[model samples]
Target chain A: MPAVIPTDSVGLVHPQTVDFPEPLTLECGRSLPGYTLAYETYGTLNAARSNAILVCHALSGDHHAAGYHSVDDRKPGWWETMIGPGKPIDSNRFFIVCSNFIGSCRGSTGPASIDPATGEPWGLNFPMVTVRDWVRTQAALADRLGIAQWAAVVGGSLGGMQVLEWAMLYPERLRHAVVIAAAPRLTAQNIAFNEVCRQAIMTDPDFHEGRYYAHGTKPRRGLALARMIGHITYLSDDAMRAKFGRDTRNGKAFSFGFDVDFEVESYLRYQGSRFVEQFDANSYLYITKALDYFDPAAAYGGDLAAAFAPIRASVLVISFSTDWRFSPERSREIVQALYRAGREVAYAEIEAAHGHDSFLLPVPQYLAVMSAYLERIAQESGR
Target chain B: MPAVIPTDSVGLVHPQTVDFPEPLTLECGRSLPGYTLAYETYGTLNAARSNAILVCHALSGDHHAAGYHSVDDRKPGWWETMIGPGKPIDSNRFFIVCSNFIGSCRGSTGPASIDPATGEPWGLNFPMVTVRDWVRTQAALADRLGIAQWAAVVGGSLGGMQVLEWAMLYPERLRHAVVIAAAPRLTAQNIAFNEVCRQAIMTDPDFHEGRYYAHGTKPRRGLALARMIGHITYLSDDAMRAKFGRDTRNGKAFSFGFDVDFEVESYLRYQGSRFVEQFDANSYLYITKALDYFDPAAAYGGDLAAAFAPIRASVLVISFSTDWRFSPERSREIVQALYRAGREVAYAEIEAAHGHDSFLLPVPQYLAVMSAYLERIAQESGR
Candidate 1:
């Protein structure tokens, strides 16, 4: 790809890792001794180090939240449309720190990371990590970066879960919490989908019980199938209809065999194949597990309102109308709980057809809401 | 499992196969030399032979549409709740012919059927079947049964597609069409989900290119995964939340590994495993292919209203409130199209939480609607 970075783009950026020698305790009652978090910084931290915004990523997202990794890179980071110099996130006005979650394969401590004791990839040996655990690691990264508090903690989808965790676990670390297209917990249907995806990965012979790293051959088909399942959930029915419909590949009539007939099938197959190229199957297992275990309200007698006791950060919950995966109702659940807890919370249901993935897209009204909300944060509570 | 049949049950039944010796041409430009269709009958044909109702089965469904297989049978047929002496379908009032579709794994001519020429299972060699093709076969079966035309053709989900096809392709063959929770055509999202499930089966190493019988072992994992995926789509979010919720299996704590943690996951896993025991992987491929090819409107210049030109049967369409798989809006498409064609059509949106499976259940309102509609069909058009 040519150097076509837009004027408002975050432009060229580099990733960095912050190491922590201290053991990190996990919600699963396990600990990782001396781990590292890979992250990328955009713009600059203010003199007081309070202007930093913690940008968390969804499942399978990495440290590169925005900007071109290199001139030859085909696509900029995911959410690039939402995070740029003059965009809703406005990299120019706020220092942004986007980090790979601890259980991610993106140069972070995860299943694919090497164990210090055995000098081998942790594989299945890696401790289970939760949203709270990820939030704790992000907090450590903030401390290492000398930022006592963030201007705002922002994310969407699973990333949005982290934003909530920050408010629940380390509420004083951020002034604004932007939880976009997230649910406070996984529903039975949600867990069922996750379980099915995991089964797709685990059932593959090449999966080798998540120790495929030793075998040198990963379960590509399983991982691909898992991604395909996830992809369908990410896009709304309207989005798929608009993009593919019943159109066939090359306008070909039904081949009458077990080959691709509809364009949607071909599209899903292509996306599934592409996913295995960059994602680790073992890490997918860990990520989904974390998602299933994200109900903080469970500890409060299943009362979300009661679980918001630790929140000090002002919350902004945004939902897309067509996001059936994490529907607008889920956002309202968070809003209702926050309100019941007497915490400051704002909610806006954006009308978008992209479904759960709308959070990463540049929907006009969505962008406007974010810009207005962040601007108010910058002006009224300047760091 | 003793003879515990209910008072109103159809009681023990036997499946019968009708053999056809003529070539069956498919829309895919292929033909089956000869075929056999397994079916079960409940209620005797009247003297005028006009009380016959052809009951279509959905994807993965079989000929046993109602009644107990034997006195030792543990459960009745899939739709036992709705079809009996005093049930909505009222086996006593209607001569019900529930036959396995041409491309299904039941006692029918499908991929797993033995080829007379080769003395082996057809497997991948089986000609692709469509909804119209299935309807044609049903017509042939009706000719064999000495029923000139059915009183009503009834089905739901993929089965419901057959009812519409009966109306469209063989407009004069039936007097009434009762389509429940069926879409006029599959949306892009619908096709995408089907594709993923197909991929799950096709990609399994044990699939052996749809000739898994040659391997003496089937792609159990792939078939199981596909069923797991399908099971999730069968129910609505609210349905699942009400049934399983986030409850863990046996109320156990999360094991923090790639194992079943939630009750929903456990239920899906069991459903998948059980499915693999009864279903043929190759048959699954053909069934989903049929579902994807069921867009009659595509031939009518993508106008469903135009597609209704061939549907002469009086139609009674029903939809459940939470059937997101084939939403109530889809049923409206059929109703609107029938209206445009100046055809008699009745529409009912049953307020039930069972989702797509609601059609098979004995919801009081849904049963009342079915009973009332069929009563009208019987009395007004008596032979």
Candidate 2:
């Protein structure tokens, strides 16, 4: 196994943006003249440069996967629980890279980004991007960083789609792929939820056909409602029951009005309101469309196993028992397909109550399983 | 057993409004000086007035329970399938009375109703009404109609809550109570979904604090979004997959833009948009609050069995296997409580692909079971 780096070396990190001047083609047959990607890096690149791991984030997540963006940040990077020195993804031995996707709002070129021709935000003019486009863009970033092959590429949910894409589209570029709490392709129910969320944003008067930036207003309410809907799905019934359990917000009796009476309601409202401050409504639209459009099996003529037939990377698939968004049955589809394709793969159905969000939380068994798997990758690479 | 009436006797019906001149007290400690309830009757009440069956409508449902108000109407009543002649409820054998609940806007006194004192739409000024309050108002309507006792009180979903309330609060008034696809109380997850729907409408600028009637503009987009969210939850995953799969709207390939790409998206958008034309947003708020506040067990100090202990009505509880909104487990809570309370109860867990809406749909097995149960009620009541 690779030697663990000293814990003292891991600390706060800053994000950096890279400009790709070369034109890029999208899966939708559209071309972008140029784009910029915001990314963050942790730990160090080993002498052989063979110990690098690429981290992909889920929807609403950004490049700050680990460490605090500032000394006084109320919360550390989303994945801080698992990516510090000696942590699960262990920035100790392997250099880690996380980047906000092309159609995201966090310092990335998205609908909120300036258009070269109009000198206004791309808004509705931005071309639709797919999981394949994001993976290809990330590959380009890897090339710019002088890393020929990543030791592992890991992600959960939408991020997991990108990891699967990496294994399929650029098999030689990744040695290992970890997909957590994600489906091979979105189910009909998944698409339905995404559509409702998109409708929420687009129907907002302030959306102004996704040109809210020009109007000097944001679709805060629509974006917040979308987030509230999302937050509910991210949690399990058991988790919500344990957390709020029909408890009144301020007293033991019902307020008998439209006020946030229940603690769960208040919590959801807070989540929705807080999310709007950080997320772009148009980016939400674009990213969810990308998720709904993802169907590797379609590219392989509806044969999922065929999509994995040419992959050389060993795979790790993890699912939470309570993740109704992408249930364990969905994860089993990918594992079964990988097995049918004769790929080396590890599977774990972690016991968790946090639902789909369990992948980002610090569940002991989830962390330990991931940590053990990463150790195996380091040993196999002779890092 | 009472003789079945002629099938021709049950067909299209017109609604009648009943105005109460006296004040009605609500469970929320508020009072409405007077209110009107719009109702429709099918079949004839027996000479003794003991054969009357009160049918409560769910959220988004109104008094037009089993017929078209006019020949040119696009659709018959929402539950026309299960309540007409020779149907499961068998209006021929039971005089069925369906009423538009007080908070509803379908010719019923609600937020859209003019306040006599202010000479304006009540709007947000309308007092909150709970499930218990609705049942009480309904009981008063029964008295005004000269019905000494109702042979049965039937409802599903939110309506089912009213049925449960009838069994608990007006035990002597109803001899039989059928509660379908309901729970002892709203779970935290249930409340969360309701909160999101309410937020969608309340956040819309067009809502204008529920005074949209005065503004001459409606919160159509917000209401549509709320309905879209609701329509998703009403159908099971299997149902959506069977109905829509990954089929694109009018095309085999994705549109590469946000133009209702999926058939499910189109269906949901249609459901949302069409719902706004017939429903009132403030009524949505008030009714959901009643649903969220419905907790007979809470009122009885969290002892569900104790809450049902004093009920004299025989109970029939039905649940769909795929209803995640009020899952079988939630329905079982009511069944188990009734059992513990030593009430005469029958429980059926129907195999179904539709979710909560299974109660509203024409499922053969569900209708068969309900038919058999109602037959038993008829024989016992000498209807």
Candidate 3:
């Protein structure tokens, strides 16, 4: 049995690792002698090799973007709905590559990766990787993969930051850039939330000052608390109210005790526990720092337009109405910057109650806009 | 020297304790054998005893609601901005009382209070207290003060919740109820946040299952984290942005390491540290639990109008523009329910960017509304 692949899915796929053996300098002025990136690609390239689209994953995301890895796999990748045969990215029309970002823990060389020098997990010894560092590593990966110029580079949230960086760092490498649910830089409140999450992880006793890998333990409790807080920010107040409201876990009676009383509490706790099982606390620290440090306008005297001037890619920005984390206003700021820089930019503000997580969901309006814009890109690239 | 008591101030004030030795039944079906409520009063009750107004304090608040307790006090009480002789609360006109809630640590019978049976702090053994229980305690305090009825009941946040409870528990006891920045019940998101805070404290090694008092230590890290999270929620996003927008503690260069990159992180950490010094971890647990449990419509078959139908007090509901913690929409819900119950109600949604803390600020519009409402009440009561 070849494992009945669903008609809409890209089907069973495998991840590939590409090694960079040369020393790579990071934005923090540190250097990694070598590293590896785990990636998965779908679809095929045309003779001109211009049909490729690079997909960037957000914080806590991985290379798996559209298909299952095995027949018994319970769930597909994170953005399956928007990256199938006839979906928005349309695997049938364009070759796609999704790679796990460097500072992330998903099969990528991150803080949890073993350092050859010490024969131990890098942990805090890992150089502080910025969005620019991730982009630079990704640019090298693209070179190794022979992707001279991508038909489009697309991502959401932190992934979206990478797309913006691609536009600035390698102006001619991406013909089209799709930035979804991202900000040019984090707001004070966003930084505060990230700081809290970092505090939660760093404070856990098992954390051992980020040396828990040798302690044969993990900062599970602190990581769980961080994830729980993150989950609250991911959903809108209306979404949470509709999903759980005052609904108790056991029955109508209040627990009185500090056990799980509301369904939302149970949901958050479960999310936290599950996250701790799969996530590296050190990676969470590094990745959130990257998110907090990324500012497109920081180097250009705080002028967004001046920062955006180097971009040659035609930009498309998308935002959700209720996403307080990366609000529509943020997307508009990106669009405004693009306009000021004389860049061709398209924008759509999708009305959705899912909040920051709306970027991951298959919102009809959101998908429609993505499909419509990418369709034009597909034609323009002769895919 | 008497510390130059300003003429417009209430000058000096002190908290008084009233004992209730009889068993006090809690809404959770538990009973406290004996307890004492700590309270403060300003001004004098008129001959008719109808000039008194009950002022409820919110979570983390105390009975020291106004003026200075000692000559060299660095700051007056929490509500000093609006509680002086000529302020909106107007101690010159109304006899004001603010009592610490029973589940709180501030000079009240709370989790930190000595358990008479074991001669240890109640800790986790403290009987779960509800808003209704708080109202009952306030009613007893009223009796002890020789006041039969209050001209008005006023509070903000959890205190606002107490005002609502007073209207329901003792309809004739309060002629007017002023609810500020409060929801009728905690939303699922609200509960989720509280649950995370509780989880942080409980998981800390020093927590010792809420018996930290006996262990001779406190969950300082967990409690600090909880307060940091709370502080973020207290301010509106716009307020935070205006106050601390990526302003680094050590100039423009990012710290890269986790010490304190942004000014917001530093401020939150300072707040968390200060809160741990003045607050009890066990009380934080119990009080947040009470916040999670309160629901006026729970007993009335989820009917807000039915829950409010027995109320005889004229209700005044006020909310701030950016109070996502307890938004303006929630206040409107209260107003709508009061109208359905045929209760006299007035509503105001002040345009302020302080978020949930707007209720505590001396916003011009908010103060004007309060002064106008209380002025009418004062004239009607002939005080």
Number of the predicted model whose lDDT against the real structure is largest: 3
Best by DockQ: 1
Docking quality (DockQ) of candidate 2? 0.83
Model 1 DockQ vs. reference: 0.89
Badly placed stretches (over 4 Å) of model 1 are A381-383, B381-383
Q: Is candidate 2 or candidate 3 better by TM-score?
A: 3
**Which 10 consecutive positions of candidate 2 chain A have the poorest summed lDDT?**
A1-10
Candidate 3 wrong stretches, greater than 4 Å: A1-4, B1-3, B250-252
How do these models rank on DockQ, best leading?
A: 1, 3, 2
- Per-prediction backbone clash count: 0, 1, 0
- Residue B259, candidate 3: how far off, in angstroms? 1.2
lDDT of 2 by residue, A1-383 (tens): 11332353356688999999989999899888899999999988888899899999999999988776665566678887788888877877789999899999999899899989899999999999999999999998999999999999999999999999999999999999999999988888899888888888888889999989989999898899889889988999989999999899876567777888899999998999899898999999999999999999987878999999989999999999999999999999999999999999999999999999899888999999998999998887666
Candidate 1 residue lDDT tens string, B14-37: 999999989988888889998999
Q: For candidate 1, what is the lDDT?
A: 0.89
Taking all chains together, the TM-score of candidate 1 against the true structure is 0.98
Superposition error at A66 for model 3 (Å):
1.8
Ranking by lDDT: 3, 1, 2
